[model samples]
Target: MPTIVHTIRRGWVYSPFTCEYCGHEDQGAIHMKVGASAQVGILQDYDDTRDLAMGTAHGNMEQAGDELIALSPCPACGKRDELAVKSFYAKAKPWIGSGALFLVVGLAGAGYLASEGEPEMGLLATSPLLLIGLVVLIAGLGKRLRKLPPSAVFRSRNPEPWAHLGPERASQ
Candidate 1:
C-alpha cells in the first residue's frame, strides 16, 4: 500500500498588526506561536491533525532580536524549522527521473569497471578519475535530455528582474 506524506508548515506575526496582505487597519496584537512549516513563511499548521496548511498573510521580523515569535505550534514566527520549497529539478516530469536513473546506473557500472581494470604509464586508462568523469558526463547528458517546455524558460531566476518583481498596475 502507498502512503502520502503530508508536510505541514506554520508561521506567525512577530506581533499581530495590520493584515500582511491588505495592510489596512492594524489588527490587535496577539502573542502566539505558529506551528510546523516548510519555509520561514510559506505555510502554517492548520488543525490538530496537521493535515491542511495555511498561507502567511504578511509580517516581517525584527532586527537585533526583539519581537520574535515562532512556528513550533507552541512561537509565532519567532523561530522554527525552515519551510520546504520544491526545487526546480525535483519538480521535473517523471520521464526526466527515468532517464537520469538509467544514465547514472549505466555510467556507474562502466566507470567502476574501467577504473578497476588497468592503468597505462603514458595515459591513465582506468582510475578514480575515470569514474568521476563518467558521473559528470552522465549528469550533463541527463540535464540536456529532460523535457523542458518553452513556458518553463521563465523558471530561471535570472529572468528579467522586472518580470519577477515588477510593480503592480491598477486593474482596469
Candidate 2:
C-alpha cells in the first residue's frame, strides 16, 4: 500500500477561525499562494540514512524531492503553487545570464569549428571557452525542454508529483 507523506504544514493551510464578536467558527483558507523556491543541495551520500530503504528510494526518484521537490504550498489546506519557480529563475538570471551568454559565444565557436570540419582534437583545443559555454548551454537547454510550451502548461493540468510512496520502512 502506498502511503501519503505530509511535506507541507497543513495546520497553517486550514486553520479554524473564531469570530471576535459572535464566536462563530469558520475554517480559514490559506491561498498558500505561489512563493519563491528554496535552494537545495545535491545529496552525495545514500548509505548514511536512518532508513536505508527511504534513502535508496529517494535517490532513485529523479523528478521530485531530488532536484525539484513537490510544489505543494500547504498540507492541511488547498494551498496551490507555493513554489514560485519562474520568479526564482527570473531573479537568478541577471547573474546567470552573463555566464550563459559567455557559454553561447563559446558554443558558437565550437559550431564554427565543426562546420569547418576541423579535426575533433584540434577543434576542441582551439576554443576552450566555447567548449565550456556549450556544456553550460546544453545543460540549460535540457531543463527548458523538460517543461511544456508556455501557453498550455498550467492551464492544461497539474504537473505530476515526484513520488507518491517511498521505500517501505525497515521492519523494526
**Candidate 1, 48-72: lDDT as tens digits:** 2233323321222221011221112
How many pairs of residues collide in model 2?
Answer: 4
Residue 97 local lDDT, model 1: 52
Which stretches in model 2 have alpha-carbon errors above 4 Å? 1-53, 56-82, 87-126, 148-172
Worst 10 residues of 1 by lDDT: 149-158
TM-score of each: 0.21, 0.29
Stretches of candidate 1 above 4 Å error? 1-126, 150-172
